[model samples]
Target: MTESDHRAKLFGTDGIRGIANMEPMTVETCVRLGRSAAHVFKDGTHRHRILIGKDTRLSGYMLENALVAGICSMGVDVLLVGPLPTPGIAYVTRSLRADAGIVISASHNSYQDNGIKFFSRDGFKLGDDTEHEIEQLTFTGRIDDIRPTASEVGKATRIDDAGARYIEHVKRSFPNGMTLEGMKIVVDCAHGAAYKVGPWVFKELGAQTINIGVEPNGRNINVGVGSLHPEVAA
Candidate 1:
């Protein structure tokens, strides 16, 4: 049987994941997923928008591009927030009233691994039924013929303020009168999505922050200094 003939479940309780550029995580699969998701979520008279974010991984670039391509093909505009934590993407999606949100990361996985997860407009993971529909559309190629054309085709734009917005949201969680002042903290970002915003949040809260895993060369993520490698931070 072909990959599709005997296709098993694609999305898990979280989302689709595997070794980057490998069978389940290949660019092709992401494209199919994007288009399928757009097909499922687009609604109303106004143009639809989706938020996409990624962690620091070399394969992130490839998958992000593929997802953008697939989403836009369905006439749904895309907001690209490069290199933000998964939660950051969800916050942006809810704040901006997006149709959905996509996150590109493998969480605690090594740099060679990657995954895609989606959040709804309400900043929560999509339900099983919706995820199943997206999978069906992808595997069945039902969205191929329905692709949009011309100006109606969705566009992808970078959200320059995405990181800032997430940072502010996090800061709001702290008590209004309280601050992290005088507190010395070490934050390990895993050199992944949270590298920038993680330390910045603490610093903005008035903490003296020692940020590690903040410099991701794409390959160093989850290496020896992130939440996965806590000792490295010490």
Candidate 2:
């Protein structure tokens, strides 16, 4: 009945998560889950559109494609904002008036781990029944049965400016009277999604910024850096 209830039944304390390429995070599971989400949101009142975003993980590409394929099969259009921060997806989902939003991330996990989280049209999370329903639909093999008409086939489009858009918005959060004209800062980006933008923000604020851990080899995310292991910065 409530999103929390739905989450408790279908998702973990977080979202559906596991090691990358394993269990719930597998490509097959992502596809099935995407199809189920589309099915749950089908309505005659409006064209169904879903916004999907992901953090920078090596497996992100694989999961993104799988999810798009599955959701599209159910006639749900997908707007992809690749390699965005998790909160960025939440912001864009509500701003764009999409039917739903999904994120692929493990949120501070190592690169070998990943997860899937869902948000509602109102920019909240999905409920337990909703999550369970999707999981059931996925596991029951009912996903393939739901097909869109030629006119209804969903389209996938990339939102290339999401990062810049987020940056512009974040800049406004700084104190109006605050300026970083003479600060020297060392920024370690964990080689994750923030590799580019994190350092840029420091520079933009007029800080003498030194950036490290900005290189992601697909295997180095959170290996020895990031918020999870701040000791790496020392």
Q: Runs in model 2 with CA error above 4 Å? A: 1-10, 141-144
Report the alpha-carbon TM-score of model 1 versus the true structure.
0.96
lDDT of candidate 2 over 1-234, digit per residue (tens): 443543344478678887888766778778888888899887676878999998778898899899999899888899998876777778788877889899988878888888899999876888877877887777776567667789888999998887777776677788887878899888988887777778777787778887887888777887778898787667
- lDDT of model 1 at position 169: 95
Candidate 1 Cα errors over 4 Å, as ranges: 4-6
- What tens digits encode model 1's per-residue C-alpha lDDT throughout 14-73? 788888988678888888888988989888888899999999999999999999999998
RMSD of 1: 1.4
Predicted structure 1: lDDT: 0.88
Candidate 2: give the clashing pairs: 3-127, 5-128, 6-127, 6-128, 7-128
Determine which window of 10 residues in candidate 1 has minimal summed lDDT: 1-10
Error of 1 at 42 (Å): 0.7
Candidate with top TM-score is 1
Whole-model Cα lDDT of every candidate shown, in order = 0.88, 0.81
Positional deviation of residue 230's Cα in model 2 after best superposition, in angstroms: 1.3
